[model samples]
Target: MNLESPKVTLDKSTEETFNFLSDVKNFESLMPENISKFEVLEEDKFLFALKGMPEIILKKKEAIPNNKIVLGAAGGKLDFSLVADITEVATDKSEVQLTFNGEFNAMMAMMIKGPISKFIETLATNMKTTV
Candidate 1:
């Protein structure tokens, strides 16, 4: 399954935004408000659990300089990757799009689609305002 967010323009430059996202600790600012727990596990890993969801660990899988960041599930029931695509718009502005890619059976997708969609959308929304 693939869930994507609408592109959002940010008030910072691509370099600035990329630098911000390069740090795993910064992701806390982009999480959903209802997250029950959050912890930075390592330099490139973090753990979080949202309401009604089991704890999940995410680690930086790859980064393409100031262009994109790919975070993959380190250990969890579901396998997924969250990517942040950044594009330069101006000297101090950029546009970002968030994509959630997961391999889920039809039944699992149906069961979690709503929350998963909301989770990615909320992260994208928060990035637009606070990233």
Candidate 2:
């Protein structure tokens, strides 16, 4: 399954946003308010648990300076990647987009599509203001 989140315009520069996102711990601020647990396991990895889902580990797999950050599941039940694409709009402004690509069977996709999409959308929107 593939999911694209709405793009958000941030008041910070692309480099600023990229620097903030490069730290996996910063993602805790983007998670839903109901998140049950969050832990930073390493410089590039973190574990979080949503209300209903099992704990998930995410690791920063790749990063392109001032451009994009790619995070993937790390030793978890889910198989997915979350990508953040950043583009400079001005010296002090940038646009950021979040996307989710997951490996799931049809039944699983059908079951989680709505909630997962909403989650990604919320994350993207919140990221704008957070930055």
lDDT tens readout by residue for model 1, 52-124: 8889899999999889999999976889999999999999999999899999999999998899888889988
**In every candidate, how many clashes are there?**
0, 0
Estimate candidate 2's RMSD in Å.
Answer: 0.9
Q: After superposition, how far is residue 129 of candidate 1 from its true place, in Å?
A: 2.3
Tens digit of lDDT per residue, candidate 2, span 1-131? 99999999999999999999999899999998879999999999999988988888999999999999999999956789999999999999999999999989999999989988988898898887787
The C-alpha stretches of model 1 lying farther than 4 A from their native spots are none
**True-structure RMSD, every candidate:** 0.9, 0.9
Pairs with steric clashes in candidate 2:
none
What are the Cα lDDT values of the candidates?
Answer: 0.92, 0.92
Give model 2's TM-score versus the native structure. 0.96
